[model samples]
Target: MQLITAHVMSKHLSLSSFSFRAPQDSPEKAIPSRKLPFQTFLSFNPKKPLSLKTHLPIMQISKTLFVFCLISCLSMTSSQEQGATAYEMLEKFNFPRGILPQGVRSYVLNTDGSFEVYLDGECKFGVEGGYSLSYGRKITGKVSFGSLRNLKGVSVKVLFVWMGITEVSTGNGELDFYVGPLSASFPLSNFLDCPQCGCGFNCKDIVSDS
Candidate 1:
């Protein structure tokens, strides 16, 4: 009975040792679970709401800049159109008159911007006008002229007129008119009207015969 008991006790101790060693030597038991990084966890957290307050100001500034650029472009286009129109009118009317007629005259621009022209002592035309420069400078005036008269019987009269400006420069500021015999081959400056010149005589001979 004692021998049987000793054999059973030794067998029980051996099985206990084997169970302890099996866990320490196993590859699956040695492997550890991978843990996620803190940064990665924050980025993927679906329950957290992201605040975009810092970006709002930048977006607003960009929008403001876009609007400013658009306004500047529109202003430039309008100024160019006005300048073109003014230049066209000058070329069509003023430049062709190489010399002003004896009776054709321009009124001196005044502080109150009013002036008059007379033809044969008669009131003819007048104008009241105002102008501004691109830089916001202002010029205002009115001009009136009388009937234009010559020995040739051609006469013209002007009515009241006014002009406004956005800007002024030396190159853009003159008014001119022409008057002479239409049939004469020579420029009117080459001949002078005589004291007795009348509508019945040739303009060329009237000056020489006098």
Candidate 2:
């Protein structure tokens, strides 16, 4: 009787253990599994294929490119306008007797449309005339008028001449001067020489000995 009872108890325990294990292998009881959230987010959804998340990088690149292009275009336009202003000033003055010496070359137009001339890496002069002739460095100068009649359009012309002088080549020892129209001319003497006696004749009236 004891042996029979022990056999029956062992059979009952084995049956219980098998029943618990069987459910674990069933599809319904298994742990739920699917793609990760991040991976799913990256994939183009068939229902909403044009989602912002899916196209985020492309949008970012497009925005960046647009900003870059806009900046580049604005910079180019600004530069062109500055150049045009300088040219108009030059035309207005019409340096008829090209004042800059042969070796002097133009550099660039300043913001104020003044011409700058350089000789041996040094500033030579800045010319501006309103009702009179004003000549000196962009920082300092004196003004004189041959006649008020000559002063017509004088301001614009003088500004252009100053701009032209400022643009002259500094590497070369040559000095460039502007006369009346856009005619660029080179004088026969050094820039520092007396205007009364040297190429300064064009610049003499405005230039002072002191």
Candidate 2 weakest ten by summed lDDT? 140-149
lDDT of 2 by residue, 1-210 (tens): 011111113433332222112245456554333333332345534334435464565567778777777765544332234454322333334421233222332333333342343222222333222312223222211111110112211121343443322222222333333344443323323333322212233555545553
Residue 76 of model 1 has an lDDT of: 38
lDDT (10s digit) by residue, model 1, range 129-177: 2211110111122322311222122233222322222121112234322
The residue-level lDDT of candidate 1 at 26 comes to 55
Q: Count the backbone clashes (under 3 Å) in each candidate.
A: 32, 32
Best prediction by lDDT: 2
CA lDDT of each prediction against the hidden true structure: 0.29, 0.33
lDDT of model 2, residue 27: 60
What does the lDDT come to for candidate 1?
A: 0.29
TM-score of every model versus the real structure: 0.21, 0.25
Error of 2 at 150 (Å): 36
